[model samples]
Target chain A: METFSVIFQLLLALSILVVLHELGHFIPARIFKIRVEKFYLFFNPWFSLFKYKKGDTEYGIGWLPLGGFVKIAGMIDESMDTDQMKQPAKPDEFRSKPAWQRLIVMIGGVIVNILLAFFLYAMIAFVWGKDYVKNEDHIHGIEVLTPTLVGDNLFQNGDKIISIEDEPLSELMQANNKMLINQAKNYTIERNGELVNITIQDEGIDYMLKKESIVFIPRVPTQIDSVMPTGIAQELGLKKGDQIQQINGMDVSMFDQFRKELTTMKENNLDSFDLVVNRNGQELAFSSRFDTTYKLGFQNVFFLTHDFKKTHISYSLGQAIPEGIALAQTTLMDYVNQFKLIFTKKEAVKKVGGFGTIARIFPTTWDWKIFWSRTAFLSVVLAFMNILPIPALDGGHVMFLIYEMISGRPPSDKFLEKAQMFGFFILLFVMLYANGNDFYRWFTGQ
Target chain B: MAYYIGVGIAVVIIAFFMAATQKARGYNFWRYFIVSIVVVAGIYMMIENLVLNPK
Candidate 1:
């Protein structure tokens, strides 16, 4: 059910974003009196779901769900409206516009996306504010899952997380994860209320980079919180408030211990477990079969309830605009840096993802906060992507305009065509590769 | 957040100046400024990530 809802929300979010993006271009073209031949919510090559001709525009929904486009008259875009270009240029056409006007029409969509992202962010901020977890509040420090150790090898459970390197853990962990991402090495913590020092390597910091993941807590009680009616737990008579203490004669002191033992059962193909529970201080025993993985009737907190602490950020409307703009700028810069790292052999950019990763970002249910946050983040992503000085994008068009403004002469149409085609292929390849990464992960169950 | 926030502030300034002075010819001050900002920020983020990370 969760997966189904996630897929549904993903489709809705993508559709809305793509449509608004195309509309951003469409509205400007109409305002500038340019003839819009086709206004589509997605690319329609072979067929379309719906199309209507009205006032020089054929509005429709396309079959392809990847992206959308607005076909302007006499414009050389993905639409390949070459036949219109071959004819005499009309006054109300994109090719016949002033350089400045044409530039806006080309970049109008990008501007709209950026603005839309900002507005969404502001609304989300006003509505839900912001929530974050302090590293110190983890109580249980991060567990090292890697097979190798690079730190001053005293890493162990129950170690009090004091600081990364020498920085205060609370301040660093308080903000938008800048601390963890920015500083990925060194350590200062208190073990048994005594300060200790350790040096950790940056090689395994990617795990922490995942924006959302479940962090397990050791020595926690294993009370059955709830159960799905048709779930394995329900079928096994698991009830809320049942305190599970032992599993298959293993004295489980914590929920984590129970999980670790259950994972080992997979090797033996044991899909069932004997659960010892203390119901109202009376010891009880039962058997339950595992479903999917080895998940049992352990209580799990709702996402919103999982972290109780609040990180409130207040900014006036006057302040938030600039703040919002700044947020976009920084995100754009970070994206550019990541891209440069990939190009310069500094970091692996192949990890950059497409749809599957985007879908993965959504929570199991329809949480407006999560939706808007992811949407705003993607908006920034789109803004950064379109601003790249590649030939097929707005940045590419901007590059041409800048060159024309400087040299007082546009590049020859033949050269422009070749460059555009080259750029188109490059973008196409990138989209395919990114989306292919999603497919690969899904197929391999990674 | 602070590091990224600083970068955000810098980008806005660069964009504003670039858009404001786009018509003028000669030297391309805005372009140089943007490039410098990116370089400086890039180096800063890298160093901060490597040397001064909070444990």
Candidate 2:
């Protein structure tokens, strides 16, 4: 059922994007009187699931969910209808159209994708607003959670993060993630009102790549928020609002420390275990005889478990428009930065995922906010990818058109066909490799 | 999944047949070799990178 929700969202998002994107081309091609042979969602290899003929076009859904295409007459698209190109160009064929017209038809899909991204983001902002925890909100500051974190001397306890990888920290919730995402080796922290620059050693990278991913934890005390009825904590006279300061005579200041102490106690099965709690400015002690579970039924104050305060602000439609556009722009830039890392950083390439990875990002339960946000991000990615000058893509056709406009000559049909095949193979290899990686990881439990 | 594998197997066999026919039609040996290698290399890459690559 969880997998179903994920797959359903992915398919719905892809289908929407593909259909709208094809329409971007379909509309312009129709305007130019270029006969569109078929407009199908997903590729129809051997046969289509269902199809219907309309004026000069066959609309259908293909069994293959890879992608969709609009086959314009006299065009050497993925359909690769060379036989149609063999005959002299007809009046209503794509080849008979002006070069400028052809360029617009080629670029229409990318333009639509970009606009769609902006629209989705704008709607998201207007409906959901933005929720974040600013860096300044982390009054108690953070702890370098990565094991050994370069060394003991680099970051002092309760050090406020100033910046990472030279970028000022904005969202405290995302600070640790930003560290891993940027593959950062250096950061600035404010200790005792003085800024210090710390450069992590090579071991830090290994920690980010191989082990527990979190790089920092907010320094906060462990305070009980609820006492579970008929459980260990209630039986031991532990009540809510008890700020646990020690367990098994070991000092525990933070919530993470409390959890760690519990785990250690459970593993060792120590005969004597006690909790030291400060309740209402009064110190109290409680004994424990934990079973294998080592479960303290009292739940911690989850909201206060972190240091930062969350902020959410809604926007009017007018304000959201620019905000959404800027959001889309930044998403595109961030995606491009990450994409380039695939070539520059060895570790980055290893992390590349396929459909499985994409599916995992969706919420297990239907969430409109996250669903739209992810889909919008995908739209931006689609726009950027389509605009890359790959021969089998729309950008390929535009590249040829640009060449024709510049050199006052179109490339021979045979040449375009060869280029298309070369580009198609490269694309096929990339898709298979990424998906194969997914298969490998699933099979080997890597 | 079975359909996908079936298509892949069919494609490989047909490609080999086409390459042989191209040879009969006076295509260069290098052309046929390139086609075969590309098909084989593509499959090899998927297995090597995703499953077999050392951590």
Candidate 3:
């Protein structure tokens, strides 16, 4: 059922983007008097699920959900319509159009993708507003992931991240981006009632990306908020407001730390362990055996009980337009920055995911806010990817068209055909490699 | 054990597709066959180290 929802959302988002992207080309081609042979929502190799012809254009939905296309007359695209290209150029065909017109036609899809991103973001802002936790609101500091903290001693278990370099950290959400994008030299943190500076290393950034781990999260005390009547905690007489202090004589103050200690106990083959909890200013000890699933069977204190507060920024319809554009600009820039890491950092390639990873991002139960945000982000990604100067992509055609406009000589049709084939193979290789990584990860339960 | 079997199957399928592509594109069979093996091996090693066998 969860898988079904993910697949549904992925398909729905892709279909919307594909249709809009094709319309970007179809509209301009029609205005410029270029004949459009087909406008498809997906690739139809041998047959389409549904199709209809109207006024020199066949509108259809293809069975393959990979992507869609608008086939302009006399255009040598993925369709590889070389037979028609060999014939004399018709006045209404794409080949007979001026260089500028052809360039616009080629770039139309990318333009529409960007515009769709901006529109979605604007609508989202107007409807839901932006909500994020401020850095200062993390009164309990941060609970560093054990692996990350142990691997790199730059951060302690309860360290408050004050600033990256000299800039004050404003939003908790922006910390990782600021660190990665700026490549900060120093991290200032409030630790053990004193300010300390930790030198940032490029290797640390690489490690985080390689591991795909959140280095640290906001720390909250492990206080019992609820206990099941038939659970082990209730059986042991544990009540609400009891602060867990230690497990088996090992210090475990935070909820995550307590959980980690239990995991370590299970790994050590310990069936029973002692837990010390502070109740009403008095320390008390209790012993309990792990259940079959290795759980204590109690709920920890919720984060809302802490001082953390979410700051919301609402906008009027008029205000949303500029804010939305600004959001889109930052989103595109951030994506490009991250994309560059894939090439520079050797381990970054492992982070590249296929359909499985994409599906996991969607909530099992649908939420419109998350769906719109993911769709907007995917739109930006699609726009950037299609604009790469690789043959068989929109960017490749635009690159050639620009060259022709500048040099006053178009590359031969045969050369274009070969380039298209080469580009197709390169894309195929990348797709297989990415999907193979997904398969390997899933099969190994990574 | 499963990793080895999966890679073996992938190599066979990739080789078959590589052959089909080479035939369709009128390229030398042996040249692309070797290239396909190298590419597949490289991808497999990468997945092992970066993903499956990460420290």
Q: For model 1, state the Cα shift of residue A89 in Å.
A: 3.8
Best by lDDT: 3
lDDT of 3 by residue, A1-446 (tens): 88888999999998998899889899999999999988888666556789999999988887667777787888887546676888999999998999999999888989999999999999999999888788888777777653544424477767888988789998754666765655566888888789988885674566567677645567888888888777789889999889999988988888878888888878888888899999999999999887777777678876655546878999999988888889889999988988888888877777778878777778899999999988988889889999999998999999999999999999999999989877866776677777777877898998
Residue pairs in collision within model 3: none
Give Cα distance to truth, residue B33, candidate 2, Å. Answer: 19
- Scored against the true structure, residue A111 in model 2 reaches a CA lDDT of 91
Each candidate's DockQ score against the native complex?
0.02, 0.08, 0.09
Residue range A1-446, candidate 2, lDDT tens digits: 98899999999998999999999999999999999988888756556788999999999987767677787888887545666789999999999999999999999999999999999999999999998777788676776666576354686557888898888888665665555555677888888898898887555555666563666766666887789887888888887778898987888867777888888877887756788889899999888687667788878775344435788889999999999999999889878877876786676666778888788779899999999999998889889988889898989989999999999999999999999888866765666667656766787888
Higher-ranked by DockQ: 1 or 2: 2
Candidate number 3, chain A TM-score? 0.88
Q: Which ten residues in a row have the lowest lDDT in candidate 1 chain B?
A: B18-27
- TM-score-based ranking, best first? 2, 3, 1
- The reply for model 3, stretches above 4 Å from the true place, is A146-153, A180-183, A225-232, A245-253, A256-296, A301-307, B1-55
Candidate 2: segments with Cα more than 4 A from true spot:
A45-50, A148-153, A165-167, A181-186, A201-206, A224-235, A239-241, A248-250, A259-271, A280-282, A289-308, B1-42, B45-55
TM-score of 1: 0.65
